[model samples]
Target: MKDRPAFGDPSRLTTGAKLFLILSAALLPLALIAIFATLQTSRVADEEARARLRVAADESARSIAIELIGDMVALRVALNALGADAADAPSCARVQGVFAQQAVDGTRFAVLDRSGRVLCGANFALPVALPSDQPIAAAVVPGKGLILAISGKRNGPTARAFFPQPFLATLGTPTSRSSGFSSAIVVRDQELVLDTIDNAGPLDRMETTSADIGIGDLALRASVRSAPVTSSLIVAMLLPLLMWAAAAGIGWFVVDRLLIRPLRQLRASVAAYTPGELIDPGQVRALPAQEIRELGDTFRAISRTVALHEAGLAEGLVRQTKLTREVHHRVKNNLQVISSLINFHARAAPSADAIAAYASIQRRVDALAVVHRNHFAEMEENRGLNLRAVIGELSSNIRATAPEGASSVSIALDVDPFLVTQDVAVAVAFLVTESMELAMSCDPSAQIRVAIKPSEIEKRAVLRVVSRAFVESEELRMLISSRYGRVMEGLSRQLRSPLHHDPLVGAYEIAVAVLGRD
Candidate 1:
C-alpha cells in the first residue's frame, strides 16, 4: 500500500488550525469583557440621560408654579379692592383693569361669590368652586382650551383666573426639543392641563419622573423618548468591538509570521528529507520563534548524526563483504591444495586398500573445495550458494577422480536447484561424498544416483543418494562401516538431522535433510 502524505492527511491538523485555536482561546475572554463593558456603559448613559430630563422637568415645573402664585396674589389684591365697591359696571371695569395689570397676557381674571356664581370681572362667564381652606386650586378644561385657577383668602370673596392653552403649553416648551423629552402639566393626577406632545400613545405608559407644582395640587411630568445616543456613547459601545477585531487580526498575523509559518516550513523540510542527506543549518536558524528555531537546530543535528552513522554502516558492510570473499577464496585454495596432496598420496599407494582410502580422502577434500568455490562465487551477490550447482560439480569431480578399475561405475543426479547457506552446502556436499564412498566400497562398479528434493512433512531440502550395489561379503560391509560410519554421523549432525540408510529397496540409500536459512 502507498503511504499517506503528511501534509494533507485527514488525521493530522495543520499549523494554521492550531494557531487559530490558540487565538480563539486568548480572545474569548476579551470578547466577553468587551460585551460586559458595553452593556454597562449603555446602562449608565441611559440613567444619566433620565436624570437630566427629570431635573429639567422639575425646574420648569417650579418656574410655572411661581408664575401661577404671583398671578394668584395679584388676583387676591384685586378681589380685596373689588369687595369695597358695589357689584356694578364701574366697579367691575376697575377690577378688570387691576387684574390685567397683575397677570400675564393670556390670563383672564374673574370674581366669584360664596354661592360659586361669577359676580363681575373679565372672562367671568364660568362659575368656579373655590376651596375655602386652600389659597389656590387649578382645574384643566380641555374642551375650553383653558386651565381655571381659583384663589382667595379663606371665607373671603374668591377670585378666578383662566389660563389659555397657549400660556400652559409655553411652560413646557423650553426644554422639550432641546432635551428630547415630552412634558405635561397634570392637575391632581387626573387632568393633563398642557403637554408638549400628545400623551395618548404607548409612550404615555412608559415610566416618567414627576415634580409637584406646589400650587393647587398640580404636578409636572416628563417622559423621555429614549436616552440620546451621543457620539461618546457610540464610541463606548463600539470601541471594544473594534479593539477585539484589531486584536484578532494582530494575533493572527503574529502567530502566522512567528510560529505557524516557521513550523510549516520545518514540517515540509522534514518530510522532503531522505536518509544520508544533510539539512541546511542556516534554514533552521532562520526561523523567527526562538523555541521552534532551537527545535529545528536539534532536528538538524540529529539528521546529521544519522547520516554519519549510515555512511559508517555502508562502509563497514563493504569491508565485511570484501573480507568474507577473501576468506572463502583462501579456504577454497587451501582445500584444493589438500585435495591435490591426497590425490598424490593415492597415486603413490602400494596396496589397493590404501589407494582406495587415499582416493576417498581426496574426494572428501574435493567436496569441501567445491563448497568454498561456490560460496566465493556467490559472495558478491550476498546470497547463499545454489545447492543443485554445488552437488552437480561435486558428483562430477568424484566420477572423474574415481579409481581405474571403477571406471564402469555411473553416477546419475536428479537434483533440483535450491539456494542454501554456506554451512548447509558444505554439510550436504560431505553427506553426498560419504554416501558415494560407501557405495563404492560395497561394489566398485555400482550405479550411484543422487536425488535432491524438498521434504513433504518438514518442508526441508532432502538429499538422497541411492546406489544400486551389493555388499555380498560380510568383510567389506565391516570395512565400510568401520571406515565411514563416524564421518556420516558427524555430517548428519552438521545438517541437524539424522542420516537414514535403507538397503531393502535393492539400493544403498542415504538421505540427509538440509534446513533452510535466511
Candidate 2:
C-alpha cells in the first residue's frame, strides 16, 4: 500500500516551505478577484465606448440636417421674391436670370406650375408631378440629387431647389467623418445607399451600430464600426492585474520585515513582564525599523522608572503604617490612663453628685479609647474601623462600669459588618453611650438594643438604638428634655445626618457613611 502524506504534521515541512505555501494560498484568491474585477471593468468600458459611438453618429446626422434646412431658407426667399413681382408682367425670364446669378456650385432652383411642369429655371427639362394637397415635400433621386418642393398656398405655383451630389457630399462635416463614424442617406424600403461618408474598417470584421435620422422625406443612416474583441485585447487588460499582484506581494514582504515581526516580538516581551522587574530592550534593539526600536527603548526606560518608584512607595508605606500604629497605641494608652485617674478620683469624692460626674466622664473617655484600638487593628488592610467590633467592645465596657443601681441593665447588640471612618466611629460611640446611660437612669432593668443595618444608599448604614424604657418612662423623657437632647443633636451634626426619633417604636435611627467591603 502507498503511504499517505503527513499534511497535518508540522515537523514534515521546513519553515520556509510552510511559509511559501501559506503565502501562495493567501495571494491566489486575491489574484482571482483582481482578474474578475478587471474583466468587469473592461465590460463597462466597452459599453461606454458603444454609447459614445451612438452619440457621435447622431451628431453627424444632425449636422447634415442643419445644412439642408439652411438651404431651404434661401429657397423660400427666392420664391417670395418671384411671387411679389409676378403681377406686373411675364416675370419668368427675370426670375430665371436671378436664380442663375444666386446659384452656388451645381445647385439648381426653379418655379413649377400647378401640374408640376417647370415654368422657369436653369434646368427646365426635368418635369416632375407634384403630390396633391401636399404643401411641402422632399425626395432623394438616385445619381441626380435631393429635390425639395415648397408652395405658398393650395393650387398655387411650386418652388423647387435641386441639391446635387457634390453639395450633399460636402454637408457631412470633416469632424464627424474622422471619428470612424460614417453617415449615409438611405431609402428604407428600397435598401439603397444614396450618399455616405467613407467607412474606415471592413464590414465583416468590425462591430457595427447604426441610427436612422429623418430630414423631411429623406432618411439618413448614421453608422459606427469598431474592431471585434480578440485575444490581444484580453492580454492587454490582464497585464495590470499581474502587476497589481506583484506589488501586493512586495508590500506584504516589506511590512512583515518592518512592522509585523517586530510587533510580535514586542508583544511577547510585554506579556512576560513582572510587576517589580524591568523589561530588557535588547530583544527589539536589532529590529529593522528605527521607530520601533526607539519605542522599545522608551518602554524599557519607563518601566525601570516605574519599578523603582513602586519599590520606594512600598518602603514608605511600610514605615508610615508602623508609625500610625504606634501613634494609635500611645493615644489608647493615654485615654486608659485618664480613665484610671478619674476612677481613682471618684473613689475619694465626698459628694455622690461629684462621683456620678466622674463616672460619666470616664465612660466617654473609654468609648474614645475603644474606637482608636479598633481603628489601629484594621490598619493592616486599611479598611477603616469595623463598626461591629467597636459597638461590641463599647457595650461590654459600658456594662462593666454600670452605676450601682443600673448594674442589672441588659445590653443587646445587632451590628452588621460595616466599616466606618475614625471620626464617624467616635460620634457613633458617644451616641450609643448617651442612649444606654439614659435608658439605665430611667429604669435600672432597662433592655437596650443597638442595631447597625445597611442603608438603601451605597456605602451607608443606619444606626438604630431602641429601649423599652425610652417608650414608657417619663423620667427618660425629662432627661432627654434637658442637656441629653442637645448632646444627641451635636453628635448627629458631627455625623452629618439627622437623628430620627420614633416614640411609637421606641427607636432612634441615624444614617452614617461607611467604607466599602474588603
Candidate 3:
C-alpha cells in the first residue's frame, strides 16, 4: 500500500492554514528586509544617543561655570570695597550689609585670620579651614557647602565664601536635570564632591561625563542613563512589521469573505456536479459578493450552452483572470490609500525634521510603487526594465518631491541605455536617491552628477555619484556620515557589491548586474 501524506503536506492544509501560509509567504521578504535594515543601523542609533547625552552634559557644565564666575566676581568687588588696610576696617554692621547684598541664597561670608580664627562678619561658623599663602583655595565639607578662601596679605586677614549644598545644586539649567541628568560639583585638589543635584528617576545605566568649571581646582560632572539598546532595537524592528501584519490580516479577511470562501464552495459544487446537470441556483444565490454570484451564473449559463468539456476549460481561464484582476485592484487601492495618508500627515507635521522624515518615507513608497508598476507592465513581454528611462523618471520625481529646503538641488544623470531586472532597478533607484539627498541636505544648490557606464564584465555596469558638497564641508560630512552609512551599506548589499568612496573627489561607486542583449 502507498504511504499516506504527512500532516505538514500542502494537500493536507486547511483553508485557514493555506490562507495564512500565503500571507506569510507574501510578507516574508518585507519582514527580512526590515530586520536587515534595523541590524545595519542599530550601531549608528546607539552612537547618536550617546553623543547627544555627552553634549547635554557639556552644556550643563558650561552654564553652571558661568554662574560660578558671576558669584566669584561679586566676592572680589565686595572685598575691594573693604580696603586693603586692616586697621581702618569697616564697621561690622556695614560689613554685614555688604555681604548680605552680594551673597546668593544658601551662602555665607566670613572674615578669618592667618591662625584660622574668625575676625569679623562671622555670623555663621566656618565649615572649611582658612587659606594658606596661596591666593585662593576651595574645599568641600559634607552637610554644609563649598568653601572658597581668598588669602589677604600674609595671614593678616582672609575672606571666605561658603556655597552651601542647596545653593550649588541650583547652578545648572533646569532642562537637563528634568530630562534624567544629574550633576555634581567637585573640588579636584581635595578629591571631594561638594554637592550633588539629582532630579532624575530610575535609570538603566548611568554614564558620567565631566567638564572643567574654569575655577581653581573645580570641575562639573554630569551623568545620565541611556535607554536600553535591546528594547529599542526590538521596537524599531517590529513596529512597522506589526502594522504590516494588521493590514495583511484585514486583506486576508476580505479575500476569504469575497473570493476564497465562494471559490471553495463553488469548487465543491463542481466536484459533485454531473456533466448534464445544471448548477444549483440555491448555492449560487448563497454566495457573497455580486462578482462571485455573477461568476456562478455565467458558469451555469456556459455549461448549458457549450460542450461540457470545453466549458470547464473556458470557465477555469476566465476565473483565473477575474481573480488576478480583483486582487491587483485591491492591492493598488491599498497602496494609494497609504500614500495619501502619508501626504496628509506630512503636511500637518509640526517640525521641519518630522516633515523631512515623512518625505523620506513617502519617497521609499514611491520607489516601490515605481518598481511594481514597471514590473507589472513588463510581465507579459518578459523583457527587463529600461534602466535609463526608470532612472530618469525616478530622478525627476525625487527632485520634485524633495523636502522644502532641497528643492533647488541640481541632479544631472549620465545613464547609458541598459536593460536591468526589477531587483537591480530598485537598488539603483534607492542608491541614487540616497546619494542625491546627502548632497542636497549638505547644500540645497549642490550639483550632483550621476554616471552609469558599462563595466568590463558583460551584463554589468558601474554607477558613480559625484558631488563637491560631500568633501567641501567637514561639518556636513560629519553630520551625515553615521546617518547615511548604514543606508548606503544596505543598498550596496542588495546590489551584491561593496560601495566604494573617494573622499578626495567626493564620489561614490558601485557595480551592479544588468540584463544581457539577446
lDDT of 3 by residue, 219-338 (tens): 777666555567777888887688668767876788888888899998888777776678888899899989888888987786565456667877997897667656655665676678
Question: What is the TM-score of candidate 3?
Answer: 0.37
TM-score of each: 0.66, 0.53, 0.37
Clash count of each predicted structure: 0, 0, 0
Candidate 2 C-alpha lDDT tens digits along 155-245: 5566877777666666644353434555556643432343443544443233345555454556665555444456866775676556655
lDDT (Cα atoms) of all candidates against the true structure: 0.72, 0.74, 0.72
Task: Report the C-alpha displacement of residue 405, candidate 3, in angstroms.
Answer: 2.1
How do these models rank on lDDT, best leading? Answer: 2, 3, 1
Q: What tens digits encode model 1's per-residue C-alpha lDDT throughout 1-518? A: 98766985545766666666667668767877977887787677668767777777777787777777776665666677556643556656665675574356566877876666666765455544444455566666653434555544455566778776667667655453443466667765355545544444553323368888877677888766555456776677778667766777787788889988899899998998898987778889899999998899888988999899999999999999888888888888888888888888878889998987788778888998998898888887756788878988998898887877777779888887777878888888888887787777678888988888776756476677776554345744685578777887887888777776665553433344444433
lDDT of 2 at 71: 56
- The deviation in Å at residue 288 for candidate 1 is 3.7
Task: Supply the global lDDT for candidate 1.
Answer: 0.72
Instruction: Point out the worst 10-residue segment of candidate 1 by lDDT.
Output: 198-207
Q: After superposition, how far is residue 314 of candidate 1 from its true place, in Å?
A: 4.3
